[model samples]
Target: MSTPALQHIAAVGAGRMGRGIAIAFAYAGHEVALIDIKPRALEATAKLETESLAEIGSSLRMLADLGMFDAGELPAIMARVRFVGLADAPAALEGADVVFEGVPEVLDGKRDAFAFICEHVRADAIVASTTSTFLVTDLAAFVTHPERLLNAHWLNPAYIVPLVELSPHPGTSAEVVDAMKAMLERAGKVPVVCAAAPGFIVPRLQALIMNEAARMIEQGIATAEEIDKATRYGFGFRFASIGVVEFIDFGGNDILYYASRYLAQAIDPTRFAPPAIVEQYMEEGRIGLKTGKGFYDYTGVDPDAYRRDVLGRSLGMLRHLDLLRAPGAALRPKE
Candidate 1:
């Protein structure tokens, strides 16, 4: 089925994630309904509505103060989001083209939320769980139309983060995934699809990095401040220009193979041992740019041009960080 125009958006649960999602869509000029699905006393519900809007307004004002947009537009953006209590959830959800389930991560909570959401929303309305813990396949059991359900894992501070990882189950429809991608693209989000897996993409990669960083601290290798500085200026700087796999390809797989072997012996073999693919690549001579084969094929690519492009990307990052300087300029004494 063709994707419907996602003009109306709803975020159920009215929590931190839901508020973030609401602001993200509202910031992109879409009208959003921030619905609190739990039944509560009238006063409690009213208080929650007040708190949700207050936090959203505070975030918008902070963004405006940072020159992200004119302060004048805050009113318009804030107005685009409405707080709906449990009694109004059905009406709010029925009109949504996309419904993001942002309820707590507990299995029972998610099951009930999905059941209530599916009961209210149109069958074709995209039902995406902003779940960081559960797999899309697991949540699909709670949803009525499994094909229309998927996991959209948005990073914290979701309004600013461009990435939204879309994890679809085996039964999820291709059309549904395509439609969700289109909807996110329209909202200026970078949506990448991945199979239903633990931790999705960014989380999976980041968890390893975080654990290593913690291990370094535990081993007294570096202070927290020193590690963060190194991450910002060294590790993150290069990565901002190229992807991890691309960096391996550019540097040569042999480098990784040797380094991994050394680290495995020097530190922990379980954590540092090279995977089978790296060993296979080393044996087959698919080293990298030098060999014209690696994680990415470089067979048709011009070697010199590709190197120049990589250099350009690094230079662009240096310029962005204001670290690029003219040759011999630093050596010259200031006037």
Candidate 2:
């Protein structure tokens, strides 16, 4: 006879990412219980999660307009979600096959929460942390069953963004890694395994760029708008499919080597040299994007419009490049 399917799941924390993660599992047909410390937080998270799902439904309806489902389907999806407080987290998690800890980005707090979870969760049940900053090995230190702990880092707005970085500590079993990956994929996420390095893969690369961008703004090398334009239109388009290493290989090692040397000499060896202008802008609180006043004024700008426009254009160009054999492939370093 076939074994029973892993059914019940629980998500700890009712923050932005926690709620999104809970909804993702619910959408995938799992029974999910969400736990938050405060009643008001739980109430707000429940409402927001429901609304976000409706927005997703609206987008799908506007685009593909799939008749197989209706807007009412959102409420049905909501029915699968249940909210609980700290006292009930254990009982709520009873029989859970997977448990995700979406706690605050604090090391100590997460340790305490995961320890509490360990007291009740099944020994074999998979436990994961949605920490973007902490290393999986470090967090796993607090887990009773370290072998079952893994870092399942999801980008913001968890349901939509396809990338889910699954990082496992040295003690973590291969089965746990595979299980987490399989389950995330089933829930409509594209899971990528990452080494337990600082900030992992994506964030590490992205951070450097952002830091340099901020520094550029401070130094007056470029305005925030210009910096974004160069990355989005100029460098972003080229880097989307083929990463930097391959780009360098394709662009010819001589240029990359010369550029590296130039940067090494011209720029301070200490971290990304916070350009003088960037320091001033940051001191004055002109941190870009979210702030209405950064290096430029986005006071009247529609943030969503920019996001949709950029992602839409990038995705379109990506598809086109794939069809054309991606000219950047020539630059990839030989394996």
Candidate 3:
């Protein structure tokens, strides 16, 4: 039997991240109480709620128009997300199964948010800080129950993005991580656990790639349009079919080893040199797919079937991008 949806979900900080997270949970068939950390007069709170709910309603309508659900379901979906002002946060959070604290990026702001959260949230509540700025360790000192705290780094437009990067510190409970994973999965999210490192996963990798893209432009390696085109047709297309490390294995680690050496020598060794693991793998005869080993073991896998599946995925991407053509079509001159 499938797990039942979470009983109570609360998102603190009714701003963009809070609103997005609230919509995501509400769309998953749960009512989410969205509370703003900022205090205001009753009239101001009412105004904020009115504007915030309007935005939420419009966002839901936009999603519906995109065929996320029925267009007519907007009212019902919007009704699931209720806004709570600072005055009502304690009562609103009393029984919350999971509380997402997305107050702000500043350290003082997080400390204040946690102090408020711990004072009212139930002892068993799985409290998470939806912070991309601070690691779980950074905020743990402010929490009453440090084990309940971890970082649930949601990408922007949280309702649409499927991935949520979960970073847990050493003091975090194993069960809390599992519970968060299960809860997120039940809400149709993909959760990947990573160490409490700066940039987590996607951000760190993208930072390097994005900086390189900018550097290429600065160096006049390619025009902006050409760079984007190449990325779409070549770099992005290839990675869409296989992961970075997986691609290394599929293409043979030996290729990267030599290419790295050549680039290091020709351009800049500091920038292009391969990590020690690559050279060590080559020395150990664990080169790649042909050698039956590399970053991942392929001992029991059927090579031909894997090859076909990868080809099919790559072809699918090309087909989607409208770049697929008859074999050797590029080789023939245009009429």
Top lDDT prediction, candidate number: 1
Q: What would the TM-scores of all predictions be?
A: 0.97, 0.70, 0.92
Candidate 2 local distance difference test against the native: 0.73
Ranked by lDDT from best down, the candidates are 1, 3, 2
- Give lDDT per model, in order: 0.93, 0.73, 0.89
lDDT score at residue 51, model 3, on the 0-100 scale: 86
Give one digit per residue, the lDDT tens place, for model 1 in 207-301. Answer: 99999999999999999999999999899998988889999999999999999999999999999999999999999999998999998999899
- Superposition error at 152 for model 2 (Å): 1.3
| Highest-TM-score candidate | 1
Q: Under the 3 Å rule for N, CA and C atoms, how many clashes does model 3 have?
A: 0
Give a tens-digit lDDT track for model 3, residues 60-145.
Answer: 88888888899888888888888999888899999688899998798999889889999999777888988887788888999887
lDDT of 2 by residue, 1-335 (tens): 11125578888887678777866777788888877643456667568546644654454444235553466667667677777776677788666888888888888888788878898888878888889978988887788878988898888778668889999999888888887778778888999998888887788888888998999999989999988878876788877745565443333334444455567578864553445555565567555555555545667878778657656765777677564345677798866
lDDT of 1 at 273: 100
Candidate 3 local lDDT, residue 121: 90
RMSD of each: 1.3, 14.3, 3.1
Better of 1 and 2 by lDDT: 1
